[model samples]
Target chain A: MIEVEGVERRYDGVAVLSEVTLSLPKGGLTAIIGPNGAGKSTLLSVMGRLQKPDAGRVTLEGMHLAQAPGRAVAKKLAMLRQDNHTAARLTVRDLVAFGRYPHCRGNPGPEDQAQIDRALAILGLEPLADRFLDQLSGGQRQRAHIAMVLAQDTGCILLDEPLNNLDISHAVRIITLVREAAQALGKTVVVVLHDINMAAAHCDRIVVMKGGRILRHGTPAELMQADFLSAVYETPISVHELAGRLVAVY
Target chain B: MSPEIRARQITHRMALLALLALLAAAAFLLLNARGSWDFLLPFRGRKLAALAVVAVAIALSTVVFQTVTQNRILTPAIMGFDALYVLIQTGLVFGLGAGRVSALDARLVFGLELGAMVVFALLLFRWMFGPAARNLHLLMLVGIVLGTLFRSIAGFLQRIIDPDSFTVLQDRLFASFNAVDPGLLTLSALIVAGLALILWRLVPELDVLALGREAAVGLGVPQERLVLGLLVIVTLLVALSTALVGPVTFLGLLVANLAYLLLPTGRHAVLLPAAALIALITLIGGQALLERVLHYDTALAVVVEFAGGLVFILLVIRGVAR
Candidate 1:
């Protein structure tokens, strides 16, 4: 399980994540849905060890993340952040191969290559494997980054807005892959999602954050009430039941 | 595509280029001399060694700096290292009399200057690049302000110093093809070789760092410690090169970009050597042209800067940088 307790992160004396505490059991897809500035991304960043909390502690399976070795945290939890920029011109394959860094350090063996190939195949990036990242379209680039994270093959994956710049087709493909990562591979997937309906439809659990605080956390059916979501979002959100799944409409 | 195959191709091309650049630098050094071969050989040989030292220092530091900062257009000069160097030289002359400055042991003074530079950089940056430091732009801004301040102080000191002292200071302030110290060359080579060995172990991490800070951290590269180590090395390198031959502001920018354009792979293993070779080629070739063609009408630095400035403008306009 991944746990965050009293995690507070501040920037310039303003708290971005204010004493937030949450826990995620192993082998589940938990989508954190929040409006802008709700601290969802900040929370994920803290848990992933991309940034440390000003106060509070985060742990994975009873191991203190901050105290653990860098490679240890990396192996247990992988994070793919939004701003994926590269100074060097790297091909898709090279980028994915880097995902295996924590596993092989720098020296790669056949196992690392196999993992990279699996990630590429799962993302339908085999054809674009040779292309430079700059040569790819926006959607293709998004998929390439996602492939890199998946190639990491960690027990828990934390992605912040992984669907950015992707079209509906690619978006749906990625959502499906994320679901498989949880169900088939039994990896804990905590994704900061923007689209509430997608979160309700696909995720096993939903966390609603507002004003740097968790407003609600429950199963989709439990938290998908129209009035609760509307207050959490401050925009009128209508919730409906469709095909035995809760659909959030805004 | 098989990245291994692509890397192999780039390595092969870089190897060929490296061979050509070495031969060209050698030929430029060994070619015609009007005086005795024995005297001329050593004379040109010292200059060659000086150029090699400066070349390796600038090329290696710029590449590593760019990797850590993830900014291709930025060189060590931008960090105010050379400006600090000028400040140290000016202050030395201003404090100790010009007669004393010239009388001091050159090697000892060079070592002191290098030490002061490295320490200044460490003190300036260590507190700023702390764990909470998120913005690299902050570092650049501080660098710009510090560089200007150092230059201003140096300028003020120069104006007050005696003319003879100013003349003595000028030798330290400007890069001179005719003025590399033979005593320092052997020491500089050993340092560069030592740094090369240390940097070799860092090659893989260097490539990962080019992916930006968060990515590097996520890859378990110990980003902060690694960056600090690299910054110290970069400072030492800039300090050595600037103190050894004065500063060549644009040579690093030119060589690094040329390496990026010429080498196919992003691996630092290939990029660093390729850039160093390219630097050697440019320095040696430009010196050869300055001597044989222009007849020393102007400083080689001026000509190289003019070309490098053009390349810089072209690169910015093309918007190919990160």
Candidate 2:
């Protein structure tokens, strides 16, 4: 389990995340939904240890994340940020191979190579494995990054807006793959998402954040209501039942 | 672009670079062999060794510095390293008096300058690369400002000093490849060898570091500590080369970018050696041409800097720096 306790993060004098606290158990896909500037990404980064919290502490399975050894934390958890800019010109295979750094420390053995191959195959990137990242489309680049995270093979994965720049089919494929990882591999996956319908359709739980605070968090059936979303988003949003699944429209 | 093919390409490129570097070294040492072997070997060999040391130092330091800073166009010289060298020289003349400074052992003076530079670089990096000030643009702005300030202060000290002291200062400041200190050359070779060992252990992490701070941290690198160590190595190298041949501002930028262009991979193991060889070829090859072909009409540093400046502009115009 991951626990965030009274965490506060500020930028300049403004509070980006104020007194945010949450608990995530060991398995399942949890989707965090919020508007722009709602601090969803900030929260995810804090949990991933990419950014330090101004106050409070975060822990994974009784170990304080900030104080734990980096490799230990990396082996247990992995993160993928929104912007994936790199100065080095790396091929898809090269980028994915880096995910095994915590495992092999730059010298990949046969097992590490097998893991790399598996990651590439799962992401459908085998054909583009040797192609430079700059030669790929935005959606393909996004997939390459995702493949790197998957290659990490951690117990927990934190993805901040992973669906960005992805087309509908690819996005669905990724979400489904993520769900499979959560259900089959029993890994805890946390994703900050923008599309509410996608979140309702796939995620086991929903965390609704607004103005740097969690407005509500529960199963889809509990939180997917017209008035609750309308107030949370400050816009008229209607949640309708399409067939047997809930579909959100605004 | 299969993996096998890509690996072969890198190996072939490395072999080609090694061959060119060897050719340049041969041309430098054997182009005009009029003297006896005993006289020519030690005499020309000292200069060649000095050039090779400076080339390796500049190449490794600049490539590592760019990897850590994640900026292609910035070099240690542009960040005020040589300016600080001038500042220290001027301060010594102004404080201890020119007679005392020149009377001091040359090795002692080199040690003092190198120690002060490393200390100052550490402090600057700590201040500018703090958690809140991690923006590359901001760091570049600070470096430029600090560089100008150092130059201005050095200029002020130079103006106030007596004519005799000013002359002494000029001798120290004028960096010529034609006159490298033999004693300093030996010390520099030892230092570069030691730093290369440390850098060798860091090559793997360096490739990951090129991915940026956030990504590196996410991938389990101790970002702050590693960056400080890399900065220390960079400071030592820039100081060593500057103390030996003064400073070649754009040589690092020119050669480092060239290595990146020549090599297909971002692996520092390959990139580091490639940059060093390219620097070696540029310095020795240019020196040989200036002496043999050009008949010593111009300093090699001047011609190299001019070419480097043009490359800098071309890189900017090509929009590759970002």
Best by DockQ: 2
- Tens-place lDDT digits, model 1, residues A1-250: 9989999999889989888999899998999998899999889888888888899999999999888888777777789898787768899988998898888876779999999999999989999999999889988888888888988889999999988998898888898889988999899999999998889888999999998998889999899999998988888988878889788787
Candidate 1 residues lying further than 4 Å off, grouped into runs, are B1-9, B131-134, B307-322
Candidate 1 local lDDT, residue A83: 79
| lDDT string, candidate 1, B48-125, tens digits | 888888888889999998888888889878878878888888998999988888889988888898888888889866
Error of 1 at A46 (Å): 0.4
Tens digit of per-residue lDDT, candidate 2, span A1-250 = 8999999999997999999999989999999998899999999999999999999889999999999988889898999899998879999999999999988888889989999999999989999999999999999999999999999999999999899999988899999999999999999999999999999999999999999998888999999999999988899998899989998888
In model 1, the clashing pairs are none
Output the number of the TM-score-best candidate: 2
Pairs in steric clash, model 2: none
Chain A of candidate 1 gets a TM-score of 0.97
C-alpha TM-scores of all predictions: 0.94, 0.95
